[model samples]
Target: MRQPRPRPRLLPLTPRRLPLTAALAALGGLAGCISGDGGTPPDTAPPAVHLQQPAEGQELAQPALQVVGFIRDDRGVQRAEYSLNGGPPQPVALTPNPDGSRSFGFQAALAEGANRLRVVAYDAAGNAGAAERRVTYRPPPPLPAAVEIDPSAFAGGWWDRYGPTYDSNPALADHGVSHTHLYGNDAGYVEYAFTLDRPPGTALATLRARLSSNFPGWSGPADGESDVTVYLNGKEQGTRRVMADNGSGGEYRFALAPADFVAGRNVLRLEVKSGSAKKNGLAIYYRALLPGFVDTPISIAFSAQPLPSFTLEPLYAPGAAAFAIAQGADALYYFKINRQNGFDVPAQNFESTGFTGSILGTDLNRVKVTFRKDLSSGDRLAVVVQAGPQAPLGEHAFWAEGRGGGVGSSPAAVNLRVVACSSGCR
Candidate 1:
């Protein structure tokens, strides 16, 4: 909250040092005014105090709390003081910062459980104004163990996946062209090699490669070619050419025919050749999708996995809203927000399937929605809502189909809204 500055107060004038005749006249006038039908003085308004920090019933992790507030009055603030619980109060000095805001902070340890913090302001004449808040203090949680990774320490055929790519760290010799592997200038090709722990009877199913483009604002087109060859038991089984898009990067998917895959220790290699490249990044990971056959030796790391189900509830306002399902698995609930078009806002992300139980002791099982920002009392805003894993990999899309509307408009406005589902959808 923002507040206006207070105005200054006026002082009363005092009568002193007069001649005997003037003094006698003034005394007589005062007596007459008191004795005549003089009405009682009007009651004075009390000074007000306002608090701004550590809102009521807040939980804190630190022992020392910073108290922030301001004073309001018919006249300007003269002085301020703070107190904890019912302890003796101390005066607080107000200092203005460069931003034109006045602030004061104090350090004091709070006891466990509920603690009361108070602030009082005083005017020039010693009139008092005060406000306070009740907060709960709790200790902080322990830190987790540290983990480190070394680029050079990585071994096996998978090393190539982490090396330079067309969009990533491109070859300096090639005039910033994207390339895989950073062999010395004399060498022309980069090798991506990885070792696989294949089970004896486990034949290869699909060989998946995961890679990425450049970060920051250095995104553009790159002409590159890659050849992937798979080996089983020290023998070459099959090979395929990697796919490429005109501008965007994509994962390369290769499905093996039965004869192309064999059981036991496997090796995969990728040789990439670049024509023209920019400042881009690349990464590669192989995934072996096997069903029911639990005993596999090779461990595949892929980012595109289905996410768990969850629930959402709106807090603070009412209305019907629609969430645009851009990607990933999601579950949505419908609630009435306004009578017009049945106002419903999308709820926060949840990882649970059933909203049957209470949350934080509140019955939030219903599709309760909360706005990221405040909305006007009568204004209805269209919001695009989504909850899922980050982009490009995971699979899932949800929208009210047919009854709500087509994919273009809100379900209420369009006819036959279509919900599309892709791979890795559960």
Candidate 2:
């Protein structure tokens, strides 16, 4: 049989503070109260105290609380002190009141939940009086818009899907005339709303909106694009002076922090503020506010083989140098891999899947790679990259990781670089 454990000894607890009324009541015998008919002897009664602000059991939205009131005695009030929720007492300044008595006032920062305020007043003879009040401080909740708009409301000839079709088609223009959706002098407005998530974590991984405009052959005005204002739940977020990437159509994007966004429903409004006749038309394409899958990454790699260590170079298309990696520019990186081991390659669904990698702290601009196995040196899956839709024009670096081969074979990761589209590109 197991031996019984001895009972744990309990420590003595500290004394709890008495309420102001109770504490002053216990001091009642030492000091006499004011006479019922105001006939008390001058030296017999103690000072009197009263609370003037924040009446008992009041609720407040602001944490900064003001305590004000009057203190009086026949021989004159000496000093006043106060405390909140049993904390240390702080001295309150006394000012002369118009009624021949003295008044006291001070401010205090209140903590959340119920707060107990205690005030003390004393006369020159050392007699004391006490009073108390209760208050509560709480902030209101954030408000989210309970509205939404259909995604199809943005479809038209001037606008297109976000994919390859979004690219500008000069052939669509008539006799070298620029094809653009016009908005000038008067504002063109559109509204949409969406419901995010609550509970504080990552509800939506990525929120994106892509758009662009068309510029006619004319030199137009100095500040090319029109003012595009974005509003979130009736408040201004930012304003973009949007124009095409040169005279041609170039995609422009705006992004928001996932964590800072409110939980639940939210509203988004876009307005094209008044513009001039010479420069107000835009070829609007691929505009959407979309939520994306962030953590849903499928295992991808070069091959399922006992990979031999080797180096690789940046693979790009012929027009890449002139155009760079542009917004909505789809790129395929060709890689020659030797999969001498087993099969670790997943089947490709090019149109449905997207691939991505990170360099330093920035996410690499890459879409999907639809390649398969060939057991030759650097001969299989090609790493596809897309230029940063929001990244600046410069040389960018990243790594491409391949499938991890089982049975004593390790996975492979290759370093790569892609030059972003330059601002000078049309």
Candidate 3:
């Protein structure tokens, strides 16, 4: 609504006689109104600004910023300007809106970390107003150089009782490391286990193993002894006749699609059918492990994207234990030595060494064991039992590695009793 404006006054005149004084007074008043000395004050308030782009607290991946919004004011808006982090202000492209509002847009560079974005609107009277937004920029995680694993590291995991033992053979080459190979006079089955954690996304998983096989030069089909069949988690991955090359073995690599694997673990097996059980004549599927099989783990690799976080869980949980051993964790195991009457037993990890750690019996024997993560040695864990007269007479124990690595056996067994007697003892 507009304020009313003052109008010029008119002159007064007599009906019969002319009054000079009255006429003069009326003329003076009319001149004063016509001169117009008083009026409304010039617009002094700043232009109002509305920013519509780069919403507050937005996370961005790139370094370029697009700013957009409009200017509004009772008086005409003169210009729109923007600044990055309070640096010098620069004019932006302003276009007139149909509703008489002025719109603007511009692109600016964004540096890493927090950026203070300010947009200001100015009126022709030089009055100004502004709106501000604080934005942030973060870079994505880097891709891994490569992901590789070893299968031979888990050789001797489990083997069928009917066949020759599946063990690592050293001195195969100059490396001085052991390779799991088939080299017995009879035929049977040997199994190898492998596992993986949850991958970031779909990945092309591959396994490359050094393999070779040999037979005792039996009288049957001379060439049948060297062919080998392969299986992944019991599913056939197809058979490949590994050339013995006089038993020197060569490197073999293959790809496994994403669907061939689960979120956590997978197992691969190689079977050789060389010395059949017939004795007089048989293609032992080692002609005993499936005919002739040899495996030397080189390296296994998978392509994966970056994941924010992932937790590793074991696939097999076959046997049950007494206390801490009853439950398994990534880095530790837990159990209760003596059950507290009417109360739940708390599970826990070993404190380097101690007794009264109430773990009884053995079931960890069912777990597939590997050498130390750094691939050091295979020494089994020693279970120490501390007993007393007040405690139960006899307690058994189950064990699994609280740590990871190659399989090893316990150095010695424990069954000692520390009987505590008091003055009031019966």
Candidate 4:
């Protein structure tokens, strides 16, 4: 049998309550730990900020730059302000975000040089959060002055599909003669060579010239219209079909690219293309305005390949017994002639004549004779004959003396019959 357990004394239950003043003090203390605004928890964490524009340490051109960024705090942001260069803080409006955050924008009045910008945000609990950035301000430098290249500094000559036929040095001059076409079946071009010290970089260069399309027609699309293909350094730059009103010439301009130029040798080619075989002309006095460039002295003389010297002979028989001319007539005549009577070899000879119009009271004593050699087209000898207003009207025979190539003038003498003009002398 188990021994009976002794009965324990049961103590009476006591219910204790705090004094009213003490309970009130405890509640007040708890309330003081929390936020006073709408029973929210106390906010001890400072606000965090992120810059959205005008990145930190960035250089700005304008002084009045707007700084954009977002500010966040555990408690709602009450107000925000920004201080530039330690100046007085200017209040900025805070925009509420969806994620319990706010954004603020302010235009900072930055001084020249480095500026220290400080943005501060405050919460309802007076907790301050700050974001700082260092920025720089600078004014842009002045632009470089434009340098104009002289027209006479260029070199090269007129070219054709066959080859270069005429050499024009210091390549800027007025040409009022018949030039072959550079486009269509009859193709030709005028090329110029020059050099530049430096490139124009990003700046555009201006090229102005006076030219003629040689298109004789009414003042419409085809009138004064010429197709020009511009090339730089053997690379095609651009093409333009321009029209000119005046017969003397038309003013045309082209904008050259800075990359088209080099420090050393550079070639500028103007190719003229036309459906008709009419002559086109290019005048002098063009301007090449290049920015940040210095002219480089260069020279391009004669053709690429000069033929060896040979003899001179008539290419065809004289068709007429005597050629007729009017008084005071200035004309240039071509004789189909060559050396060795074929296009096998290139040749040249000096020609002289004795015909003085001293008794006729006129200066028709000297005559100029030149040779034009084109391998593709036949060769010829050009003679310039000038007759004064009071020239003698009669048949005159003249003999030509030839030197070099061990050859003499053929056919003995050329017959010339002077006649009076029916209207006016040309």
TM-score of each: 0.27, 0.36, 0.33, 0.42
Clashes of each: 35, 10, 43, 4
Residue 416, candidate 3: alpha-carbon lDDT: 23
Q: 1-426, model 4: which lDDT tens digit per residue? A: 999999998544433244665676777777776646336565788878665545589776557666766777776788888888999989988766445667555576779999998889888888998888999987433323444434444455553323333223222223322221112112356666665655544344566555555422223334434567778788777776655433234456676665567766678876665453442433332332233322221122211111223332322223333334457667444444333433243345343333232212223544566554532234555556676343343433333323333222222223334443221221
lDDT of 1 at 361: 16
Q: Sorted by TM-score, highest first, which candidate order results? A: 4, 2, 3, 1
Superposed by TM-score, candidate 3 places the C-alpha of residue 299 at a distance from the truth, in angstroms, of 9.5
Candidate 1 similarity to native, TM-score: 0.27
lDDT of 2 at 137: 86
What candidate 2 gets wrong by more than 4 Å, as runs, is 1-42, 97-99, 140-194, 198-267, 273-279, 282-426
- Please give, for residues 1-426, the per-residue lDDT of candidate 1 as tens digits: 889889887443445444665687778878877887445434254456645455688776556665655455664567788888888988887753222233454565688778998888776667777788999887543321211212122333322224332233333223422223221111022333343333212122454444333321323334333444445334454545543332222455544333333333334433332332221233332222222211111223322111121221122223323233333434432222333333332322211212111111112223222344332234332222234322221111222211111111112211111123222111
User: Candidate 3 at residue 81, lDDT?
Assistant: 86
Off by over 4 Å in 4: 1-42, 56-66, 83-101, 104-117, 133-141, 161-200, 204-211, 215-224, 231-235, 248-255, 258-269, 273-426
Flag regions of model 1 displaced more than 4 Å: 1-45, 75-77, 95-113, 147-426
Model 2 pairs whose backbones collide: 214-283, 301-402, 301-403, 305-341, 306-341, 336-378, 336-379, 337-378, 337-379, 355-367
Per-model lDDT: 0.38, 0.49, 0.46, 0.51
Worst 10 residues of 1 by lDDT: 401-410
TM-score of 3: 0.33
- lDDT over C-alpha atoms for residue 212 of model 1: 32
